[model samples]
Target: MKRLFFQLLLVSDLNVKDKLFKSAIAIFIRLTYFVSDIAKEKAPQLAANFDKNDLKSVETVFKSGLPTPDEYAREKVKALASNFDHSELKHVEPQVKTNVAVIEEQ
Candidate 1:
């Protein structure tokens, strides 16, 4: 099915052996789990930004090895906000708290 194919494609891309790709995927996977609402908000931006240049940014976050997924997502989001200079960055903290509460209840 087309849906399955797309899912496979996404997963394959995420599983790339490159450290930067892995780090970005870590961030994305964590977003999918802990903060899915925020993930939804970020996915499109991530898709658009997932390029050679963005990999440099992701790489800059990890001097030695990959960080935890939450840390990756936070840095990635902050990087995105800095590039955009948008007001949406202001909403992320409150959403993070709400999502944490939701996860705790589960």
Candidate 2:
């Protein structure tokens, strides 16, 4: 009985979160799918980053519109800085911005 109720709660929570997250994202982003990977390591950057911590970063990034990489992401998100990426040098951009910024170079 308890397990069944937990499952029901999870479903409803997902529905509410889906609606809310989509509605918020639609306000600003207009993204499209792209193919990127190597050998057998292929996945969407956004989804891959969000999946870092059981999808917690999904809620954080989606809510704040931050293209955050895992471990660099925040939780309980609210408003973010317009220049959120400028964590250090204000006059120059970082060589490596985020996890997805640069996959590799040879």
Candidate 3:
């Protein structure tokens, strides 16, 4: 059982890492494009074009590689698993009442 649990964690961890890496790459690409766009316009300051969208420069960043739905949901799943791991249920003590009496049948 322990081995199975670890295997499951390992698989899920791999998936999360892949998704996270792709998402990081997407963000980096987007930031790079955004900067290049600002430089293209010969803007004196960043505030002038800070609100402009740069998706035009790298259109595939969002459509091809990103933090997909699976990535979003699995992150929460991992957090819930961590919470279960640290829960007090494993250390909980059974509460019993000593006042109960046993009756003998005649």
Candidate 4:
């Protein structure tokens, strides 16, 4: 069961990593805002030191080769899937549905 859960978590096509990355950024932004509010109340001079441009420029430090979480997950999943020939498990193709359905509660 644990292995199955782990495999699902590492499923590349599900875009779990992308969703996780976005969620993490949202949480970080909220935490930053909360911290800044506290800093502004306790120490205005210290809080003033944080500049938006300085923070924005921090992204430049990361190299171009830096893979986003989704890319990393895809690579890992691909590697794992490649090794499945040795195991008893089989890879299943994903299915797509074009129709949509909506049911409202009474």
Instruction: Name the regions of candidate 3 deviating beyond 4 angstroms.
Output: 1-54, 57-59, 85-87, 91-106
| Candidate maximizing TM-score | 4
Ranking by TM-score: 4, 3, 1, 2
**Candidate with the larger TM-score of 2 and 4:** 4
Q: What is candidate 2's lDDT per residue for 1-106, written digit by digit as tens?
A: 3455455546656766676655444432322112222423544555567645756877776879855566255432333555466646654555545434666531
User: How many clashing pairs per prediction, in order?
Assistant: 0, 0, 0, 0
Tens digits of lDDT, candidate 4, 22-87: 556556656767886887787876577868887656766565559889999999999998876743
lDDT of 3 by residue, 9-35 (tens): 566567666776556655665676788
Reference-based TM-score, model 1: 0.21
Candidates in order have lDDT scores of 0.73, 0.51, 0.62, 0.62
> Cα deviation in Å at residue 19, candidate 4?
58
Question: Candidate 2: which stretches are off by over 4 Å?
Answer: 17-106
TM-score of each: 0.21, 0.15, 0.28, 0.29
lDDT for residue 3 in candidate 2, whole number 0-100: 55
lDDT order of candidates, top first: 1, 3, 4, 2
